[model samples]
Target: MKGRFVTFEGIDGAGKSTHIGWYIERLRARGIDVVQTREPGGSALAEALRELLLAQRMPIETELLLMFAARRDHLERLIRPALAAGQWVICDRFTDSTYAYQGAGRGAPGERIAWLEAWVHGDLQPDRTYLFDLAPQLAAQRRAAVRTPDRFEREDTAFFERVRHGYQDRARADPSRFVVLDGEQAVSTLRVLLEEDIVTLCNT
Candidate 1:
């Protein structure tokens, strides 16, 4: 049997991590064979690379390359194996993050990113992706309150705004696979919306 792959993405402090847990709970309750994971740090090597990528001293280009490298490892090792066994793969972030942070935010060439994605993913794409939408300033404020900033979190507001818009552009281009949800709302409200969306997906 084929498996479903879903990914969640957003700028820092968009509540994706928090809500992903909620979605996992829902899936598990429904008896789905779910595998919850995150990008840049799923396998051991990838997790180690995550620390290096998120370190304060790394250059932006190096960070982008490391992110993709971690993703490549994740796909080949964990993601592909789990999906082949007919398990739902729920990832916290994926290639959309590269386009947002590297291409749009860091001014890398979109064509190059596209080529890399094509080479790595082939026909593999998320069956569904939920983008937690929020203003960059609001997200920054949330991040500041929660914990110390990572390398990307400490970036300037202008960069984050570009990332935000990048996510919007990707979602607009692929509405069939991407769902944009308001991140400013209460957690319960967002959960209800997500539940509705899941019901719609399951029925189709």
Candidate 2:
């Protein structure tokens, strides 16, 4: 059987990262083989690109290209192989992030992103995507309480608002593939809900 591709998405500090490890543990407890990874990462080359992408300030078009370049390397080196081995691949973020961050936040043309998406990994989408939806202000507050902000994380509230709307738009366009979660919910409550969703996905 082919393994499922699952992704977690949200604006920075939306709390999606908090559940990733727990979700992986849950799958392991059920005897499922799994590979946990994140975008602009998951492979050595991609990781190198990740550091540059996170810390360096560059043109929007350059940033978008680098993002997809990292993704292409990640898919070829890790994601595709893991799935072929029947191991579930749980990624922290995916192309939807590009649509949100680069396309919406940076005002890059949607068509450019779409073209890159097709070129990088055509028709290869996550079987399930969990989007933690939160208001920009709340997310910003959460971010401030955490570690120092990175390049993308340092964006103002307006940028995050655009990104948040971008995520919502993607979810609306593909409701069947996205599970929109409320980021403000209690961690325990969110875990219970996520557990149920994981169970259903595993069974399917």
Query: TM-score of each candidate?
Result: 0.96, 0.98
The local distance difference test score of model 2 is 0.95
- Residue lDDT tens for model 2, 31-121: 9999999997999999999999999999998999999999999999999999999999999999999999999999999999999999889
Q: What is the lDDT of residue 27 in candidate 1?
A: 80
* Winning candidate number (TM-score): 2
lDDT of 1 by residue, 47-138 (tens): 99988888757666777778888988999899999999989899999999999998899998888889889888977999999999999999
> What TM-score, to 2 decimals, does candidate 2 have?
0.98
Full-model lDDT for every candidate: 0.90, 0.95
Name every residue pair that clashes in candidate 1: none
In candidate 1 the C-alpha lDDT for residue 140 amounts to 90
Worst lDDT run of 10 residues, candidate 1, spans 56-65
Worst 10 residues of 2 by lDDT: 195-204
Model 2 vs truth, CA RMSD? 0.7
